[model samples]
Target: MKKWLQFLVLITSITSTSALLASGGIGEGSEGRSSQMPPVMNAKWKAECSGCHMLYHPGLLPERSWKAVMAGLDKHFGESAGLDAATRDEITSFLVLNSADKSANRRSSRINQSIPTNSTPLRVSETRYFISKHDEISASTFKRKSVGSSANCIACHRGAEKGDFSESQVRIPR
Candidate 1:
C-alpha cells in the first residue's frame, strides 16, 4: 500500500509538470517567450487614425473586419474618411497584423460572427460587445471631460494602448 501511494504521488507530480509545460508555462516554456513584445501604439497608426477618430486599438477588430473597414473608408460611419491608397495600405496592414484573430479569446476571434455580413454599419460601435460594454454610460456622458468620443478608450481604460484594461487602472475624469 505504501509503495503504491508513493508511485501515484510521483506520477501525479510529473503529469502536472508536463501539463504546465505543454500549456505554455510562463518562464518555463518557449511558447510565451518573445524577442520583444511590440508596443500597443506607434507613430504611424496614431498619425492616421487619430486625425478624425481617437487612436483606437487595432487589436479590437478581427483581421477580416479591419480589412473590410479600410476598404470602405469613404462610407466609414457615414462619413468621407477615405485614406490615400498608400496610407490605406499601411494602415490596413498594421491593423491586420494586430487584429483579434490572433487574440487568445475564441469569442474575439469571431468578432463579426454574430452580425450579418451584409450589415451596412461597419463601425466598431455596431458590434454587440461594444454595446454591452458601453451601455452604462448616459447619452450626455460623452460631453464629460473624461470621454472625448466612443473611440477614446484610453480615457476609461488606462494603458489600453498596451493591451492593459484592468479595472484598477480606470480613472474617470470629473
Candidate 2:
C-alpha cells in the first residue's frame, strides 16, 4: 500500500509539473510553440467569422487592426457582415485581448514585427510576414479552383482552422 501511494504521488507530481510548463508560467504571456497551435479561441468569433469565411485566429492581427475590422463589419471586405451590437462587442473584446501584438507566441511575435508601427492591416495576407512566407507561390496557383484565393488558408493548410500552419502539413491543392 505504501509503495502504491508513493508511485501515485510521483505520477501526480510529474503531471503537475508538465502542465505548469505547458501553461508558460503563472501570469506569464501566452507564447506560441512551433509544435502547438494558437491558444486563443472564442466561440462567438468562430461562429460569426466562420459564417462568412475561415475563422481567423485572433493572434493573426494586431489589436488596432482587429479594432478597425470590427468597427467596419458593415463594410467587411465589400460585404455586410454586421453583427448585433452585443455580439460585435464580445467578439471584438476577444480579438483584441488575443491579438498578435498582445501574444508572446513565436508566430504572433513575428507577425507583429513584420508590420510597420503606423500600419494596421485588416488582412493577414497583407502582412509582411505572410507575404514573405508566400512569396514563392505564383498568382495562378492561388487562383486555382481548389485554392480559391490567398485568403483561403485552409485550401493549402489543412490545419489552418486549428492555427497549425507548419510547412510540413501544407499541401496546396492542385
Candidate 3:
C-alpha cells in the first residue's frame, strides 16, 4: 500500500509538471505560448476594417458593443466608414458571433469580466481590463511618436493582428 501511494504521488507530480510546461507556465493566460494565435481571420472583416486602421479582433469587445459600432459606421470614430447593406451585415454577424462574451480564450474572458453590466464600450482601450493591463504604462509613453496612442496596440504588441499579446513578447519603443 505504501509503495502504491508513492507511485501515485510520482505520477501526479509528473502530470502536473508536464501540464505547466505545455501551457507555458501557470497563469500565463491563453497567449502564454509564443506560438498561440488568435482565431481564424474573416477576410471581409480584415479588408474593410484594416483599410482605415488596425484590424481589431472581434474577441476584444462584447456583442452589444460590436452591434453599436456596426450600427454607427457612417460616423465611425469621426470618419465615414459606411458599407453596403450586405457587407455590413456580414461583418456585424462575424463580430457578434466571435465577441468576447462568446470566446473561451482567457484574455477575452477577462475583458468580458471587466465590463460593467450597464455599459457598452465600443473601444477595447476603454475597458477596465485594458486599463488594468496597461496601468504600468505612462500617458507620455503612449503619446510618443513610435506609439502614437493607446489605440495603436501594434506599437508594442507586434502580434496584435494575430491576437497574441503575451507580456513576455511586449517591446515598448523609445
* Candidate maximizing lDDT: 3
Q: In terms of lDDT, which candidate is stronger, 1 or 2?
A: 2
Which stretch of 10 consecutive residues in model 3 shows the poorest summed lDDT?
Answer: 28-37
Give the whole-model CA lDDT for all candidates, comma-separated: 0.66, 0.85, 0.86
Candidate 2 residue-wise lDDT, 11-48, digit = tens? 99999988876654433334424533466678888888
- Put the candidates in lDDT order, highest first: 3, 2, 1
Q: Can you write out model 3's per-residue Cα lDDT over 1-174, one digit (the tens) per residue?
A: 999999999999999998876655554454653233356578899999999788788888999999999999999999999999999999999999888888877778889999998999989999999999899999999999999999898999987887877666689999
Candidate 2 — which pairs collide? 32-105
Worst-scoring 10-residue span by lDDT in model 1: 28-37
**lDDT score at residue 36, model 1, on the 0-100 scale:** 18
Arranged by TM-score with the best first, the candidates are 3, 2, 1
In model 1, which regions exceed 4 Å deviation?
Answer: 1-38, 105-121, 143-146
The sequence of per-residue lDDT tens digits that candidate 1 reaches over residues 50-117 is 78765666656777788888988899878888778988898888887877656544334435454455
- Candidate 1 vs 3: which has more TM-score: 3
**TM-score of candidate 2 against the unseen true structure:** 0.79
